[model samples]
Target: MALAGQPNVGKSTVFNLLTGLSQHVGNWPGKTVERKEGTYSHNGISVDIVDLPGTYSLTANSAEEVIARDHIIKERPDVVVAVIDASSMERNLYLVAELLSLQTPVIVAVNMMDVADQQGLKIEPEVLEAALGVPVVPMTATNNRGIRELVEAVDELTRDEATYEPKRPEIREDHRAVLEELEHLVAAHVPQPYPSDWVSLKLLEGDDEIMRMMEDRLPQETWEQVHEILKEHEDAVLAVASGRYDWVGRMTRAALVRPGVGQITLTERLDRWATHPLWGLLVLAGILGLVFLLTYSLGAPLQGLLETYVIEASARLAASALAGGPSWLTSLIVDGIIGGAGMVVTFIPILIIFFAMMGLLEDVGYMSRAGYVMDRFMHLMGLHGKSFLPLFLGFGCSVPAVMGTRVIDSRAGRLLTTMLVPLVPCTARMVVLAFITPIFFGAAAPLVAWSLVGLNLLVLAVAGVVINRIAFGGERAAFIMELPLYHKPNWQTIGILIWQRSLAFFKRAGTVILVVSVVLWGLSALPTGDIETSFLAGAGRLLAPLGALMGLSWQMMVALLTSFVAKENAIASLGVLYGAGSEAGLAETLPTIMSPAAALSFLVVQMLFIPCVATVVSIFNETKSWRWTLFNVLFLLLVSFGIGILVYQVANVVS
Candidate 1:
């Protein structure tokens, strides 16, 4: 079975509810669009369900649309569940209308029925089912309601097969002959798995994917005839959409009852403040401050406990167990892997808290309001609010932020946004700031942390404007994003998101951080047991002059360099260099070695440093150009060190 829906229609919630931890997530074949597949057992029958990308239509306007359309036509699933918002049936039924024409079994899953009821809208499932000639299951996916009935509906369709005979939409009456004529012209050349009638409709509607395919396959005469017909009825696209809307209108008219004239929804009442032009920005800023505040207040204590009990104890035990072994072996186990990677792992609690808070915001639908409020600011950089969505993802990880640029329709806007995404201070960088800032700044750490984040965004805005003017010639795109209704957040959804993200972090720590730590430790231990006389020391001394400009010693400089491999590696490298196996010891040691002015400069540079290796590779893959990737790295490098030197010099004078 396949799950299909427009964005924010509870499709993901339904998928999660059905699959739980059984799902696998990765990119689509040869595309950055995410693919989710999982198994669900219904009444002793195991069904493999693939969740297609959320798209407004099946037209090939974007990668998501192409992926979803190809999956249904080529890798046909047993059945496709068309999930739609029950409260906004008129808007969502268009996707359903498109799915019905695919000749595949489609079950209309009317999700968010509770939201519909809250708005005083009533929808009759039986009436909708009778009108559309397909199975219709009303559900509230967040509440886990009607899932059994939905599953049973799918089972019935698979067993009987005749229950899915849908009343598909037709072309407008005036253009019916044009569609039939084109169908006859290209029928013989239509590719495999692509229905002749569907191809004809797509050709008439000027669907880019179908037009290109038919253009290549059809004979010259047939192609010319099809093109001529399409040229003559250039308004056929409008006609086709009009037909779908007509079908949706009839079905909705028969099944849906509207509320009173003056009825107001909970979403509207909330949006008054959440989406206000002036107040919305303040709300967004306060919410961000609260998130960071909670991170320190709630997560910091737990992080300290792990460092004191878990990491420190593990390092001590490993040293004791290996004391009788080779001295080098003992140091490698105690100081290299455990001291470095183990220390980095202590910040897992902080990341968990941050991820959970972000998940809660997304689940409750405040993210869109943030984006809506930032739309004007984005316009200043020659982009729209849609670009902000991916940039927001950068706070968690730059890899997804770079990948999320696929949502933007304009290529130039996407590329410009990609350049600025690296500056968003991901959780890895945030963890480093969280750990080190408190050591030097003490109680004012959160204030300084917020300032660093704000500085990065300020740099990002300036960079966006500069890049947009120089490379992209300052083109702007307009967008319309639907704000989902604010509802009680589902803990299960937030829990699953936190689990997935935290698991990813731990996996990276175990692999990348582990390897880098051991390698750096070897460099520091070689030729002598003392790090001061080892290979790593020799290398850091080579760059000591540049470090002096930034008011950082050789050790701090080495940590910044190591961050390119992975942002968390900076902390791991620092632990190994300073030989502090516990956060307590490292925290004490950092303040004594560096003055407040230099420490502030170091934090500024760390926040603006080149993104980790994974994010760099993603940038290259997304842009498909080494030129753009190299430019992004060099641009950030210059900006980071330039600002670092200026900050250090000015603060050194002030202090």
Candidate 2:
């Protein structure tokens, strides 16, 4: 069985409830759209379910539509279950009309009945089933209301071998005449398995893919006749679409009872401001500001407490426990393993706050509005509106941001968005900035940090235009995203989201961070037991000239070099280089060793430097192009250094 629906119709919720933990995700064959399949046992009968991409229609205007349409046509699943939103039956039935045209066995699963009832809309499933000639199961998928009936309907349809013919919507008489002629022609020319009537309708609708296929298969004279007929009835496309809507309107009137016609709900009223051009931006800024304020005000204190009472005390105990062990072994365990990894672990409080707030925004459906408001801005940077969500996520982490590019249908759009994501100044980089800013600017730290964020966005915008001009040259794809209704956030869902993200972060800390920290420790603690003479310091010396250009000292250069492993490692390197035991100690020691200009330059460099190792790997994984990955690293290095030098020069002159 295959499940299909429009976006935000609770299709995924149903899929999760049925599949549980017995599912796998992968890319569709030769497409970036994700394919989800799972097996479950219902009524002692095992069934396999495939979740198709959520699209508004089956038109071949986007890659997702093409993939979904082809899967249903080529795979020929046993039953196609169309999930419809009960609150918006007319809009949801558009896809159902297309599905019926394919002559495939379909069962209408009316989801979100509770939401519909709350909206004062009464639906009659028996009437709907009689009208559409398919089994209609009313369900509130979120609460698992009618899932049993849905499954029984599926089982009954699959078990019965009777010939099932779907009732398709009727088009206008003129359109119907043209479709009949074209259908006869297509049936004679096209092979079996290609539904002739569907192809005929698609041809009338001016589907480029179908036109290409027909042109490839049909004889020249036959093709010329088909082209002449299509050219003669150019308005048939709109006519056919209007006819489907008419049929849906009739069906909805027959089966649905609305308490008030054209009543604007609370969601619509709020969306007016949330999606406005100017007001929406203000709202977004306020939300983002609140998120950061909450993260810093709440998380900073907890982080300091952990560092002081937990990590530091534990380190002292470990040192005391390892006093009689070999000297190198003690240094490795205390400084290399614990110190290196613990530095990263300390920031979990802030990350948790960030992730939790982001999860709340996502759960409440405002994130989609953020994307909607930013669509025009994205177009200015040669991106679609849908690209904004992943980029917004970059402020939290780059790994998932890069992975989120899968939602973009255009390959060029995905690549462009991926390249700019690293420039968004992730939470780890924010930690480094948070650590350094106060030491240099005192009470003006927040303003300076805000300035750095503004600079990052500016640089990202400019880089986007430049990259789009040089690498991506094509028509900008259209972005149509569904804005879900806002509801009270489910704390359980938000907690699960936070737990999953935190788990991924901790795993990285344990694996990549632990190994890199050990290796860096070895490089800094080699022969003679002096960091100045160590291999890592020697490597930093080689880059001293470049660092000098940016007013950065050799020690700062080493710290920046270590940051490539993980952004938090930059702070760890600072502690090891300056012999400062904690972040507070480094904050005090940093100002005395470097001028204010140089300190500011160091922070700028950290903000714009190459992404950490984990993000680099994610970029490569998403793009599968070593060339683009290497280009991002090299391009960012130049940009970071250039910006750092400019800031240093300006700051020196002002001072």
Candidate 3:
């Protein structure tokens, strides 16, 4: 089952009600529109449902709608429950009609009945059923009304195959000729029992998917005749587009009853304040202040707690193992891997807490406001208004935000955002803050962490200006966003989301991380334990010239290399190299590298360095090319190291 409807209709609520699932639902697949799946039981049978993105029609215009329509047309779900907003039948019915034409037995779940009634509009389910010739159930999914009726309808449609008479779009006389020709050819061959007129209309419209289906089956002469009809009009595709909307408008006027005045849209009032220049600016600042406070106040303690566990356990295990086991194996498992990997994994809960809160805000529709409020700032950075989401979320984790670029429209903006988002310090960088920032600056650790983040964001802003001047060479992409109405988030929904995200991290630790930890254990233990001559040590020695500038020794250089595998590995590499650098222990060795200025420069280098292997792998997958992956890796490495060198030289000269 897939919940298909127009954007901002009650589709998400219906999915929440039907599947008893709360996940981030958006308009694009893999971007804002990552495909979400959940399962529920009806009549003792578990049925799996996929929530396809909200698309306006089955025309396959945008990437999101195309993904949705392709899945339905190909996967052929057991049953599709089309959640239609009763209040906006005209726009909503366009999608419903397209689905009906697929011959996919669909039960129309007329959602937002509460809104319809409040607006003094009546939608009779029987009338809707009679009109569409399929089951129509009106319900408020949010309040759990008519849910039983919807489930029963889905059950019947999936089990019993009853062919319903679906109305095909009527065409004008000019297009009627093209339809007749298309109808004559597809009538006998196609298996799906969709109406002939619908198939004809699709062919006349030059709907590529359906026409390709016909071309593969139809005789050459038949298509030649169809092609002749298409070529005859100056812009034949427009004919079909106009005809369908015209037909949809006629059906909507007949089926839906609405007042001369629309009901008071709740979002309007909120929008006025949320988008107001002065009030909106303050609101955005408050949200940012709170988010910053959480990162430091709430997350710092948890990071400290997790770090304590890592340090104490590593010390005790190392002591006990040395008494009974081989020194090398014990050192590898206890000091090299556990001490290293554990340091990183300890921060997993804190990262999860941050992600969960961010996810909840996004689900309840508050996150978009961040983009809304940050439009002016984005403009100054030479980006469109909506670029803020990717930039902001990049601070949490660049992987999702990089993927989030699908929501951005322009090639230039997307590329610019993709390149610069990585500069924003991620949750992995949080380990650096909790571990080193305090050691370097004490009470000012949080402030330093935030300032570095702010500085990186500033760097990104300057880079954006350079990019626009060099690569984009045009105005920022057109920026418009649909701000959904605010509502109370369902926590049970948020908890499931947190479980999925955090458990994913834990699973990594148990499987991929565990294996890597073992491999890292072997790498760090073998050849030699000498800080200057081990394999990593040799590798670090090559970076000595670069390291001297940032005030980091080759040992620190090795830790920087380890950061690529995992941020925690950097800390672990250090425990083997440096002491109780406990969870609360300041990154005690950083100050020894050089002056405080060098320490700050060292932090900046770490902040902007290349992402982990997982992020690199994701980039490869997103680009579908290894060359691009290598390019990103080398570019960031050069950029990060270059900044470090520059900072060191400048600081030394000033001193």
RMSDs, each prediction? 13.8, 12.1, 13.6
Model 1 Cα displacement at 582 (Å)? 9.1
Model 2 scores what on Cα lDDT? 0.88
TM-score winner, 1 or 3: 3
Give me the displacement of residue 576 in model 1, in angstroms. 7.6
**Over the full model, what C-alpha lDDT does candidate 3 score relative to the true structure?**
0.72
Score candidate 1 by TM-score against the native.
Answer: 0.60
Off by over 4 Å in 3: 1-118, 121-229, 232-263, 275-285, 368-391, 397-421, 434-449, 462-483, 568-593, 621-624
* Tens-place lDDT digits, model 3, residues 532-556: 4567777778988878867787777
Candidate 2 lDDT over 593-646, as tens digits, reads 899899889989999999987788889988999999999999999999999999
The sequence of per-residue lDDT tens digits that candidate 1 reaches over residues 1-655 is 9999999999999999999999999999998889999998988999999999999999889999889989999998889999999999999999999998897899999999999998899999999999999999999999999898999999999999865668999988999988888888888888889889988888877998898898899888888888888888999999999999999999999999998647878898889888999988899889988987898688778877997898879989988998889999988988778866776667777778878887899899998888889889998887778788788778767876787788788889888999999999987898899888899998999999999999999999899899899998887766678999999999999999989977865674456557766887788799897878988788888879999997798989888877876687788778867888766888888887899999999999999999976678779878999999999999999999999999999999998
TM-scores for all predictions: 0.60, 0.67, 0.61
Error of 2 at 495 (Å): 2.2
Ranking by TM-score: 2, 3, 1
* Better TM-score candidate (1, 2): 2
